[model samples]
Target: MARIERVDWLMVDLAPKVPRSDAIQSFVSQETPIVRIIDSDGAVGTGYSYTIGTGGPSVMALIERTLAPLLLGREAEDLEALWRDVLFVTHATTVGAITAIAMAAIDTALWDLRCRRAGLPLHRLAGGAQASLPLYTTEGGWLHLEQAALVDDALAARAAGFAGAKIKVGRPLRQDVVRIGAVRAAVGDAFEIFTDANQAFHVDEAIRRARAYQELDIGWLEEPLPADDIDGHARLAAMTTIPVAVGESIYSPAHFREYLQRRACSVVQVDVGRIGGITPWLKVAHMAECFNVAVCPHFLMELHIALCAAVPNARWIEYIPQLDAITTQGMRIEAGRAYPSEAPGLGIAWDWAAIDRLAIGAGQVTLGSSGGKR
Candidate 1:
């Protein structure tokens, strides 16, 4: 019986870079608390959970104190069973970012284990829907940047072989229009233009800006207002010709249900970390599929590429090169399209040496190891 052996949580800190524009909170530098799982034969699998500054400590604690102990010596082959088992044990309090981080850490590791065992790439192991997925640039689109610098950023992405580029919005309706117009003019109408407000505006303002950029052919208006405002998203979706997009901050399947039920978004932007791990995220993606909604996954893009490729409806995946500094063999994007690796697991592995160097001891991870209820 090949059973589980050990789980280790490794923390890696990223260097500071340009801050994302509209979020009330932003990361100074990315911190990834990677979970590594080794089976009885010493086969290893690795997964990453999303962690900003404040959330990592709690997430790490939950895994180390609550989850690790439960998983020890379990059958490595029972991936789905283990996922449900974890949820079952923590059913009472398993929700929100903490649940997301914990589940992502383990679920992703399970997936890595599955793929490695199969000697297949992550996408193929999940049932490859397509060989290569199209990509878009999410880097260099900050409203905080000077107009000239913003334009330069867009132009740089275009020159770097990106077919599409997204820029930040939510300053004022007119400023968004001007920025979108400039990007369109610079890149020409042939290239795809996308924008994200990061939920900074109100409902009426979101509608107004979406309408304003209609002429520039903006691909989608992402998170125009806070995620809680279902009516607002519905209103914006109905009022504007451009597609309304949301989901980075959304917490649960219930949250996604509201958007799908109301037809609130033309696009579903699922963030694997923000919505829990691969299991729940796949559920969300399937929900989007049922509703005939296009999915442009939010961030932590390495895993997203595999998810996108696994489903037929997935559109463009976001590209922010800043994460390359932390990852060992970073993803390669060419001509605006991201190509998945042929590696046995999730393709790229974490730079553990670099991770240890970056570890700050600000967080902890615990896993329940006691025997299961069965």
Candidate 2:
């Protein structure tokens, strides 16, 4: 009989000692504001939405002023109803960050509530077989790192007990090849190595680079071309012996359906936040299974560990290890795998004191702006 009684949005910012970048931009600092939901019974669940430095306040506002108002007295059990309610009310604004980020916060909190109610881990509730999931180090391939830095990182990943490592690779053709070759030589083929272009290349260029690195026994090529270029990905998948991976930026199951039907990529990388919530994520997992495609989800990887363990074809979950500063009971990674916690709910909790300390300005967020936020 516990109903959702209140929702709290808290923002946290972490400063990286160095800058991180992709094909688009570099991040010197990042922010993740966690959304906490309390039920009438006083049980609390936590969720998070991805954001950059400037947008955290806006996301917090949308959730507080817009989304929270609708669920003040609603039954917590009607999770999907509430999810759809937010979607319908925010329909006109569905194309970008504000809505999806808000949806991520609430949807994740609801799943946390479900897990707590069942007295089970999210992995178990999803029918996962193992309590631990294998992880691979990511953020290794940025062009900014020197060759020595790249090799050192790869070697470190091996030392960390990771079975695999992934790096970014959209630089000039020769530079990327040298980095990939160095990583491969350093890891010595026993370790799985993957690369992401961050949608930085033309199809022909991607195919050429992928073919070049294929000799190093690369495990997969991720987001070689733009996510919308399904035909291009399908072509790359067909031509290269290397497996082509896509998704991440895709917004819905319908988008995934097209990618699958077109035989776009061998590996599917779904984002828990962008593709709606846990429910839609489950559907996408099953759909990937039906098509015999491997899933190695995008970041915010701690949550995906349970989903990967539940789905048979999930190859590996990406690990950044940077989010631990904001989470309570940080997930323990043993030998490149994440070990699940006995804690009820998502096995994670928010550092409220840390969160409260990071708040920027207020009323920059309005309470109940649209029909609701997302």
Candidate 3:
């Protein structure tokens, strides 16, 4: 057994060249908190989680103060054991965002350790369901973009061999219809087009917009209502033939269970960081499989490509290029499909230089083999 030896973390605030807005908020930066773990045999694994320009320091603090200590001196033999120990220790604050975000760093680093030691890639380590899946982009479809720009992006994506593009919705009914229609006209009917409201509507308004969306043959309507409104989501799902997608905001597996049991959402967009980590992320995907719903994760294409490929029910992976600023290379995407890294471990080559450059350097600490910050 490899005994846990040391762990450390830092926060990197990666700014987008152009700030983008959705129905809810503007994404100023990818507030990234990074964690690295080293075991007794000297194997090192890295992991990270992101917020939309906030709470990164809080995540780092939790990791440094509580989570990192819990990891030191334990056997890294069981990922679930390590995950549960961290989960319950922060139980009071959890079933919420900050705790889950902090735990994600530790949980992901542990997976990196497992994959590297086994000489296998993450998809195979998780479940080995597939090596590739279709890819879609949200980069060009931000709510702030003009309709013509949206059309241009969709056309460009199709030309570049992307399977689809997700356009943000939640505008006035007629305007939303026109924007989608314009993109459809530009990209043609063969290229799939998805729409997201980012929880911008009530059930009634969501229904109205969804009906309009159905006429365009939209691939799916994502997060049409607030995540907590299972009853509203169920109603919206039942009323429209268009599949309703949710899960980015839902924190725990139990909450996802609530949506699935109620038949509220048809597509599960399970996010690795938001739902704790790969440990619980996989659980939710398998859970969605029981009901025959597809898993198309929210963001983090680099990591989600493998996670989505790990599950049999997953068909598509959302492509939002958040880590490009901090990573040495981007994931492989060809002919409108995404392929996971075949390199052993979670194949992300972090640009430590870039990370350190953007890192806020707060709550940063190091625990040595014997314990305590050194």
Candidate 4:
């Protein structure tokens, strides 16, 4: 059994390829908090979570002050038990973002250790249902892009051989309809198109917009309503045929169960980062499968790709590259799909030198086996 030896993490600023905004929030730069869990042996495992330009320090402190210490000298191989321990300790703060983000860093690191010890990649270790999953691009689909720009971006994704492309929609119904129409005209009827409103709609307005999108043959309407409004989503789903996809902001598997039981959403976009990492993520995916719903996860494609490949219900992986600058390698994409690396770990090659260059000086903490600050 591998005993816990130390835990380390760094806060780094990772900017997107462009300045993108959605209905509710503007993503200035992704504030990334990563964790490195070292066992008694010389081996190490890494995991991370991010916020869209906020809360990096709080997540880091939560790990250092609360989560990391509980891990000291524990069996690193029992990932599920450790995951439960941290979640139970942080129960007061959880079912929320900061605590969940902190839980994700450690939980994922433990899974990395499990996979490494078993001599298998995460996809294989988890389930290995598929070797590759279809891709859908969300890079150029911010809510602020103009009609012309949106059309050009959709066309670009189609030309590059993507299975689908998503555009943000929160404008007035007429304007949003026209924008989607323009994109459809450019990319033709065969190419798939999806829309995300970033939880910007209420029940009445969401119903109206879903009606407008039905004729467009849109793939799915993602986050059309606030994630917490399960009854409203159920009403909207009942009112329209446009598939309602929600899950990015969802914080726990219990919340996902509420949506699934109510038949509130048709597509389950379980995000590994937000739902407290792979353990709960797999739970939600399997939960969705029991309901015959598709699992197309949100951002963090690098990590999600492996989880997506592990489950039978995972249909698509959203293409949003965030680690290109800080990592030595990138996602393996071809033929409009993503392939997870077969290497015996999480698969991305992190460049420690580059992360050090971008890491923030404040709140950078590491702990030894004693679980005290060094």
The numbered model that scores best in lDDT is 4
lDDT of each: 0.77, 0.76, 0.87, 0.88
Q: What TM-score quantifies how close candidate 4 is to the native fold? A: 0.97
Q: State the lDDT at 134 in candidate 4.
A: 88
RMSD of 2: 3.2
Q: Considering TM-score, which of the candidate structures 1 and 3 is the better prediction for this target?
A: 3
Instruction: Return the TM-score for each candidate structure.
Output: 0.92, 0.91, 0.96, 0.97
lDDT of 1 by residue, 75-167 (tens): 878877888888887788756677777878888887888788778988887768877777777667776776677778778877877778788
Highest TM-score against the true fold, candidate: 4
The residue ranges of model 3 lying beyond 4 angstroms of the native Cα positions read 362-374
Judge candidate 4 against the unseen true structure and give its global Cα lDDT, from 0 to 1: 0.88
lDDT tens digits, residue span 299-365, model 3: 8888998888788999998878878888898899888898999988887878988877776754433
Preferred candidate (TM-score higher): 2 or 4: 4
Query: Candidates 1 and 2: which is better by TM-score?
Result: 1
lDDT string for model 4 (9-101, tens) is 777888889878988888998988888888888578888889998888899889878888788779888888988999899989978999988
TM-score of 3: 0.96
What is the per-residue lDDT of model 2 for residues 1-374, given as tens digits with 9 covering 90 to 100? 68776676666778753467777667666666577677888877777767655577777777777777777778877887988898888888875666777788788888888888778888877777666778887767576787888899889888988888887887787888888888888889699988888888898898788778878888888888888788888888888899888778877778898889988777888888777677778788889989998888888777787777777888788887556666676777777788766666776656666666665432222224333223
Q: Candidate 2 versus the native: TM-score?
A: 0.91
